[model samples]
Target: MGYTIDPTIIRDRFARSTNEQLIDIAENEIRSLTPEALEFLLDELRKRNIETSQIAELEKKVTRQHNKNVSRAHSALAQDLSKEGMKLAVKMKLENASNSDIQEALQNTGISSEESLRIIGSLGEKAAAMNKTGNKNLRYGVIMLLLGCLRFFIIQSKDDLNETIILLLVLSGILFSIIGLKIKSDAKKISEILEQESLEAQ
Candidate 1:
C-alpha cells in the first residue's frame, strides 16, 4: 500500500496553493497524484469559481505522463543501485574475492541476481588489468630502490664520489617507492571500505 496523507493536511495545502500552482498540478501532475489528492485539488478549484467544463477537459488530458514519470523514476533508481553494486564488486575483486562472494555481497545490497552477474562480468577484465598495473608499479619501485641503494654503496667506496649523482639516485628511488606504495595503499583502503559497506548492509 502507498502512503496516505491526512485529508485535512491535503485540504490545507490546496487552500494555500495559488491559482497558478493549482492549475500547474492539474494540467501537468494530475495523473500522478493520489485519488484523494486529486479530489481535494478539484474541490479547491470549484471553490475558486472555476468552470466545471474546463476541469472536465483538463482531466481528459491526463495523458501518459504519469506512466512516463514512473518509468523514469524506476530507471534512475536502478542506475543508482547498479553504480553502488559495481563499486562493491570492484573492491571485492581487488581483494581477490570469488565471483560468488561478490554476487552474494551485491545481492545483500538489494541488487538483483541478474544485475549482480552483469556487474561482475563487466568488471572482470578491468579488475584484472588494474591488479596487473599495481603489481607492475610495485615491482618497478622496489627495483629502483634497490638499484639506488647499491649505487650509493658503490660510490661510497670510491675516491671520486659524485655527490650530485648520489643525491639524484636517492631522490628518484624515494619517489618511485612512494608512488608504488601509494597505489598499493589505495587498493588496501578500497578493500577496507568494501568490508565496512558489507557490514552496514548486513
Candidate 2:
C-alpha cells in the first residue's frame, strides 16, 4: 500500500535527528529504491563522506538475503481472531495496560509474544515520555536549587568564619548533586530505550 509522504514531517524528523541517524535511515530506504536511484543516492553520500564502501557492502548483503529468502510463515498469520477477543485487546490497549499486562491479556489471541510486546510498547512509550519529561524537570530543578544554594552559601561565607555552616552547605550540595545526577542518568536511559526501540521498529 502506498502512503503519502509529508514533507513537513520529514523535515521535522531530520531537524530532530543527527546526520548519523539520517545515514541509517537512508540505508533502509535504499533497499526499496530502484537501482538507478540507489546509485544516485550512494554517489551523493560519497560526496559527503568517503563511506560508500560500507554502504555498498550492506546493500549487497541485504539484497542477497532478500533474493535467497526462505522463511516459514508466521503462526499468527494463520489463525483467525474472535470478535470478542479483538474487542478486549482494544479495550485493554485503550486502558493503558503495560507491556507485560497486555501480553498476558492477549494470551491465546493468535498474537505472537513479539508482536504483542511491540503493540504494547508503542502505547507504553507515551507513559515513558511523560515520565522522562517529569524526570528531566526534576533534574533541572535540583541543579538550579543546588546552584542557588551554593551561591547563597558563598556570599554568606565571605562575611563569616563558621566552619559548621560551611561543612553543612558542602555536604548538602554533594548530596543534592548526587541525587540530581542519578535522576538525570535514569531519564537518559529511558530516552535512549525509546529511541532505540523506535529505530528498531523502523
Candidate 3:
C-alpha cells in the first residue's frame, strides 16, 4: 500500500521549516500554483514513494539545528548581562544581593538568538537600576543597626543600672558590622564569578 500524507505530519513538517526555507519555497516553488493546484501537487508527491517518516526525520534535524542556535545565543546574552550586572553592582557598591536575586535577574532577561540584538542591548540600564536598589537596601540595614544602638543608649541614660542592655548593644553592633563586611566580601566574589562566566560565554 502507498503511504498517506497524514494531516498532522504535514502540519509538523511545515512548522519545522525555517523561515528562510519557507520563503524560498513560497517564492520559487509555489508562486504560480493555486490553492487547489498546490494541494494536488502535494498529494502527487505523497503518492510517489515518499515516506512520512523521512519527512519527520528531516523536520527533527532542522529543529535540532535551530535549538542549538538558540542555546548559543542565550549563552552569549547571559555572559553580556552577567558582566553588565557585575559592573553596575560594583559601581553602586551593592555587595549583598542574594543568590536567588542574581539567578532571577539572569532568567528574566530572556536573551535568545531569535530576538533582535538591540533588545539585549537595552538591559544594561535595567541591571544598573536593580543594583542600585540592592545598594539602598544594604544602606538601610546599616542605618537601622545604628539607630538600634542609639535607642539602647537613650534607654541606658534613663535607667540607673543598664549594664546588660549596654553590653548587648555593643556586642550586637560588632557582630552586625562583621556580618556586613563579610557580605561585602561575598558579593565581590560572586561578582567576579559572574564576570568570568560572561567572558567564557563570549
Tens-digit lDDT track for model 3 on 132-160? 55565556556656766777766657563
Give the lDDT of residue 19 in candidate 3. Answer: 51
Q: Which stretches in model 1 have alpha-carbon errors above 4 Å?
A: 1-11, 17-21, 28-57, 60-63, 125-202
Q: Which candidate is the best by lDDT?
A: 1
**lDDT of model 1, residue 66:** 42
CA lDDT scores, all candidates in order: 0.71, 0.52, 0.50
Tens-digit per-residue lDDT, 36-146, candidate 1: 666677677767756678756654543344455467778999999998998898778767677799999999999999999999877745444555667777777677677
List CA RMSD, all candidates.
12.4, 16.6, 16.6
- TM-score, candidate 3, is 0.27
TM-score of 1: 0.46
lDDT of 1 at 47: 74
1 or 2, greater by TM-score: 1
TM-score order, best first, reads: 1, 2, 3
